[model samples]
Target: MELKKPSDNCFTEVDGFGVAICNYAGDQNHLAILYKNPQKPDDVKLFHVNSYKSDLLTPVESHYLWVDIDWLPPIRKIAITANLKNIIDNNKDTKIRYGFSFNLGCFDPVTGKINNFYDSADGFTCATFVLEVLKSLGVELVDWNSWPVASPEDINFKQYILSQLESYSVKYPDIVTEEFLLGQKNKINDPRFKPQEVIAATKCKEASTYNSIQKPAQLVHEEVLSYSN
Candidate 1:
């Protein structure tokens, strides 16, 4: 059974992959992922992007991000909101890099490696990056956008998503359009995250789709792992 949702359509988990939600504003930002195990539960250290200029808001969820320091047991949701909107966006002339933040002392029980997805794409993979991260982390998926986004005359979210597909690198822009970004600010909102039968059924009929998309990421990750080793 799915766990109780801490917020509207938002579920929380500490052991397996936790659901992730996003909130982006003029200067404030929030990204949350849920997982039960903190690797070193007793002592935790989390590093995040210094570009963050605001105060890392404690997540509404019982558990949240960053390392917890301060003589505590239940890990405090840490954050990187220093330069957030406070300082200017530094590091110009740079394309996208992985992690885009500090290094956390998270570890993978299997490989004994730090549980950091940073070297990937600022801890994001596809435009469905947030969704994929939660899934990859082992959290189950739930439909978050069940409610219709438009009226009969209004534009459908599906089409909006297709139109926002200019950048293959990001995957789904509809997930980030003004509406989604705005909904994040409200205390009460829902992300009807559900499994898309159509997308998952096909074994990639479009041969180049996988090669063009997943290949680059796979190759990049392999290279990083090898270099680190």
Candidate 2:
């Protein structure tokens, strides 16, 4: 759910789900993911990413979170928003690298290792964060007209995400694009972000498509455990 409009409240659940509240103009930027336990109404899990968390990633980055429906306890609904207070740290006391803007803390006991944990990409800007999250869910928004389309060698993450969001807003006019662009401005939206790459020829079409496309899900051999109602 892209919280772009004044009355956009519902979140759609597909095999993949996403929630984004762009608050660029706000004093303190925050993002939170909440999970309520069905059997015990009082028990809840909260995950948060904000300016402070983003600041810890060296040069800093815009972060995102994606939770699988199967791994979670059944719940009637979820609340995703910006700027909630006093929430618990979902990754507290865990060996998993929790502070980075981009994190994959899902653990596998058999391997004694965490899946999708921190690496160089943890320095991603909001744009890269959104792109990676979408890629994880089998969607590729990358195209010839994609934002910050600099040569891969000179690509900047923040510019890329902002550009992508802008394109999405134009592509889906029914969805509000303004809110998606309103969050705390990234530290890197400089002149480099404005240059539009000209597609002189389709010579690199196949390679470009491959880079922009998502990896096939079947290639990852991880076993996914699921429970039924």
Candidate 3:
């Protein structure tokens, strides 16, 4: 496989609550969404996209797919799952589960522009779809399949990525310092190199105003930004 990194455009500032993972190598790319069930996170449902047009996230093309979290106002938090079956020997000898959690508002589905998903406070969550571009950056295909069927707390990808990001920022502060992008790169390319710069990129938190909503808000209020940003 060709060692590559994600395009620079993928790391730009984004403004949507949705995500799209692109696979330029083959046609086996897949998308998955974590549907939040009120405050009960353990009960969240994960649905794999089958019908692009009618599904939560639409596939603009085989290499790109997206979804609007706003479409599901009831969803408190959403996790983007990247199916690395094609890139990695994505199969399980035993049923293992692992994933991380991030604030859902980090992505804006209504606007397709890029945004920073890192906050340096919340730590690493499942920003899978956003980091899919790392394949080209020489990130090993094996790393992508690290997700096991376990709770977010049980997963260690977040801490592993944080250390990577902190180091990359020290050497390359001029460019985008988001961990999901840069961390994955360094972790794969130079795992042994200890970075001098401290990694500050962390996860963001979702707003609490909607915590009491009984039904999906018809129209998301502009003031929602009070907490989202």
Clashes of 3: 27
Worst 10 residues of 2 by lDDT: 220-229
Query: How would you encode candidate 2's per-residue C-alpha lDDT over 1-229 as one tens digit per residue?
Result: 1122213322222122222322233221223333333334444333323331232112111222223333322231132111111112222332211111322323332332224554322333343333333333323334423334334433344555556556665877444235334531332332121101111111122323323332221111111101100
**How does model 2 score by TM-score?**
0.29
Which portions of model 1 show Cα errors greater than 4 Å? 1-17, 20-22, 26-29, 36-38, 42-127, 137-229
lDDT by residue (tens digit), candidate 1, 114-182? 345423222221123333432232222323233333343223432333333324225645433444323
| Structural similarity to truth (TM-score) of each candidate | 0.23, 0.29, 0.22
- Highest TM-score model number: 2
Location of the lowest summed lDDT over 10 successive residues in candidate 1: 79-88
* Ranking 1 against 3 by TM-score, winner: 1
Sort order, lDDT high to low: 2, 1, 3
Q: Which stretches of candidate 2 lie over 4 Å from their true place?
A: 1-16, 26-49, 52-122, 144-229
Cα deviation of 201, candidate 2, in Å: 24
lDDT of 2: 0.29
